[model samples]
Target: MANRATGVPAPQLLFDGSEEKFDLWETRFLSCLHILKLKETILREPDEASDEDRWKNADCYAELVRLIDDKSLSLIRHEAADDGRKGLRILKEHYSGKSKPRIINMYTSLTKLRMADSETVTDYLLRAENIITALREAGETMSDGLIVAMTLSGLPDSFKPLAVHVTQNEDSVTFAGFKRRLRVYEESEKMKMTEPTTDNVMKTYTRQGGGHSKPHSNRKEEDANITCYKCGIKGHKARKCYKKVWCNYCKNNTHAESLCKKKGGQDGVRKVAEEQGGDQDHLFKAKYVKSDRPPGNVKMKGIMVDAGATSHIVNDINKFQSFDNSFQSETHSVELADGNKCSGIAQQRGTAVIHLLDNAGRQHTAQLRDTLYMPSYPHDIFSVASM
Candidate 1:
């Protein structure tokens, strides 16, 4: 654009090629000459040059730049003895990193970008943005739309819904705007995880007697007739109900009040210390397995191999072919990672014999010891940690 007052174009910034960045500098110098319409004069034949003063003006501008940029002056002192254009060309050939391996590395980095499973959207966006910036500096032109699409596509599978939301938006997404949306989506997902779900509310009510308890077939007909005093639900006896006898001591439900590791409150729904199966003097931590799945009956198909568990567990007590029902009225609970405990569990005193085939197709028999049984458990957990 020409200057309105002087009818001459505004001067362009001079480059000294600091940090060995000659590609960018060279482009700027060439663009300045083009903008001033002096590039044709410098490229003209000797006869054409004689017809115009463009070549002379281009040379004068280059020399002025060389003088103003101290770094350029020292590098071109010998090369540009007569014409500044020669000095500029040599400077570009010497310092331009176009042929360097860094350009390939930058492209590789951009292509390999990924969002880790544990990485938050905010952190991943920063990582992708840095890669995009490096690619741009290496002369790669990535549009904001491409960046938005790539970032959304590179996100972990859990963000598929967010990706859909982005694609479904009517408004064009700026890179900055997409980041804000990503952050909002991240927060929403976090809230969803923390908030109580419908199933959780249903379970809580079912356990508290506000909802009907699923009947256990082994429970006595008389016991199942009336509501349980412990859980305030109809279907099972107080002894059979899985409602946890909250323990005041140890701050967990791992044991009933009577079986608490420490002294507990007396006014709650649990039996007194002396009323529990064992003598008060013998109260101790029971052996049971803490599993992720709830109770159900599915035979061998339900078995789970879990290294995180300290013991093997089965959800259905009846599935145990040789289960010892010695502690029929006794309630044993398993401790969870969240510090809560579930009461529908028991430590088995018997063994289970498994008949299987090895890789050689030969039949093999294995016996498991002290397997746990939880009448309410859904999956059979075989703990490698225990083995």
Candidate 2:
């Protein structure tokens, strides 16, 4: 091989190969390359840069630089005016249609904004306190959740006193750590106020005579105070007297009978006869029998009737069955005193008559005008003859 050397390509010349011109062009090209390389390095770095560092980067500052370069600053001024009008409209709508929940959400959002460094905590607290005060003056009761939220948003303990009476014991835990300790003392005071005392427990049993005497238990004492009419004593009723008097209806002192002259005397005898006549003259008079035994007997002296009752009733149905065997009618039901019903016979009275003799041996007849039914008498019998 021959000893020949390869040559390098010459640099493309700019501005006609004068020394000053070439030097100036070379400097400009190298500076442009350096600026591009710096931009690439800044873009490749993580966004963990501080605000000042980000502002210093030429690529990030390019928008401001372009705004300064362009003579269209009036466009920026017009956009700012439009944004202000939009903000005013939003504020008006927010204030006009806001509900309690919306207000609370707005307050929470503001608190969060302040926490994130978009607003001052003191300003947020002042605005929130004004809202809470207005709500209290409007007679609205705030919940524990709202109070806790306010406290967490940097509201002071001075606002705590405003809600003291409204707060419940269970809601005390929702407050800040220092406020909860004060709430424990408040609860203790409430407990002391509600506790029962010994004086109140004994007040009910201290009345005048009620403590010494109960009603049924003091019956003997009550009887001892009753005045006796016969013997003229203070300790006994008239029926319990020891002295005895002559029979008012008889001449004898031992007993009184129907024929006794003392009973048939001028004044007493006439009075008795007139009373008996008045009893017999009543349109409806019946005898009611009373006994203190089971399967009791009741003797009916007159016709037993109830014109006011809806159904016919005759006591002692078995007694009338022997007298008129064919007097039986359809068996109907009647209610007894114990709430059970009894089956009985209903009969038509075609001139049903009852006869009875008075104490003077004078006979009287009682007439019936309607149907009568007889059921078994439970314990009492009412009769018209007794009148």
Candidate 3:
């Protein structure tokens, strides 16, 4: 795909001249060559390569030259551009641990390695493996036992149990075996935390000073007593109601397009909000509203009108005229089209300025009441349904 900013095909690999990341960069470079069916051409010797292969190798060599930094390219500039194999060998030899200082640095880094809190086990292992690979290529020996010990030593305190389990096991633990057992242990621990407990139910009965309590009904029995809003039937809520009463106008399942109150305009905002699950009485929805083209002075591109949006949302705090910082609690959140909730502790609601331009190019400003302020919101949305 073309890059959005540059309108050019983005480079597949971008190497920042660092010896630590060279191995990964080389692997990706070779993989790209393989995909283009030019890996064989690059690998073949100049003497053995056919006339057609020589032409293909030029493209492969160009890709190599494009990916590497200027400093790395200068090392192999004397090598023929048509001979990718020889140029790549020269680049590899230069990067693959020729310096004594670099080897010592790598060894020092390996010893001082400690997993960060934000890093996952797999990511930490990959980092350790990269250093080990670099050490081996530098002619330094690395044993599997030493590799396991180094890997285990770098893990954070949370992974101590897994380390202990690996060490105390009857069978010797390879790095591969430890990874497998770690996956299983992590999943099992998650299951233990998430699984529901009857301890709360038992505690409820043990509470003091309460009269003889009636037995709680089972979930199925409770659902049977509840009425569904969608179909006016017992046993389920509107969300679970099987009856499909579709309103094509509002795209709601509760009613038909022909019977849609929203078609009448502002009168249906409250009714539509109720159906859409917005509990806030002051929820804004744009049913029908006239707006003129905003002149260049106003940032018309920054403002977006969402027809399906249940509330007006503003990203910038400066847009608010008179704000209510405590308007909404932390638990109150706005739902997105993708079924994800957007919430922040700093979220506020109040009157906001809405800039507009008339047909005569006269600038006008209107007050947008009950507009939500989400500092982390991606866009300033004017809800058509909340008008």
Q: Which residue runs does candidate 3 get wrong by more than 4 Å?
A: 1-11, 48-54, 78-82, 98-100, 137-140, 192-387
**Stretches > 4 Å off in candidate 1:** 1-16, 19-35, 39-54, 57-69, 81-85, 101-387
lDDT of 3 by residue, 18-92 (tens): 878889888888887887798877776666657787788788778777788888888877775656777788888
TM-score of each: 0.30, 0.17, 0.44
lDDT of 1 by residue, 1-387 (tens): 336797454444455545333444555656666776656544443543352364464564454354336766776666566454566555655554445576676566666778888788877887776667656655777888888877776788888767866784557899998899889988988998999652221011112245643423432543334443344455544434577656465444443545442353322323332232121112112223223335453222324455446556765444455865664424656654223556644545455554444446565555566677653333356666556
Model 2 CA deviation exceeding 4 Å by range: 1-331, 344-351, 371-375, 378-387
How many angstroms is residue 135 displaced in model 3 relative to the true structure, after the best TM-score fit? 3.5
Q: Count the backbone clashes (under 3 Å) in each candidate.
A: 7, 3, 8
lDDT of 2: 0.38
Query: Please, what is the whole-model Cα lDDT of each candidate in the order they appear?
Result: 0.54, 0.38, 0.63
The Cα error of candidate 2 at residue 267, in Å, is: 40
Better of 1 and 3 by lDDT: 3
> What would you estimate as the lDDT of candidate 3?
0.63
Best by lDDT: 3
Write one digit per residue (lDDT tens) for candidate 2, span 103-206.
56545543553222343434544555455544443346777576555545453443344344334223344434435554464566467679963222101111
Ranking by lDDT: 3, 1, 2
Residue 223 in candidate 3 has what lDDT?
A: 49
The clash number for model 3 is 8
C-alpha RMSD values across all candidates: 16.4, 37.4, 23.7
Model 1 lDDT on a 0 to 1 scale: 0.54
Please rank every candidate by TM-score, starting with the best. 3, 1, 2
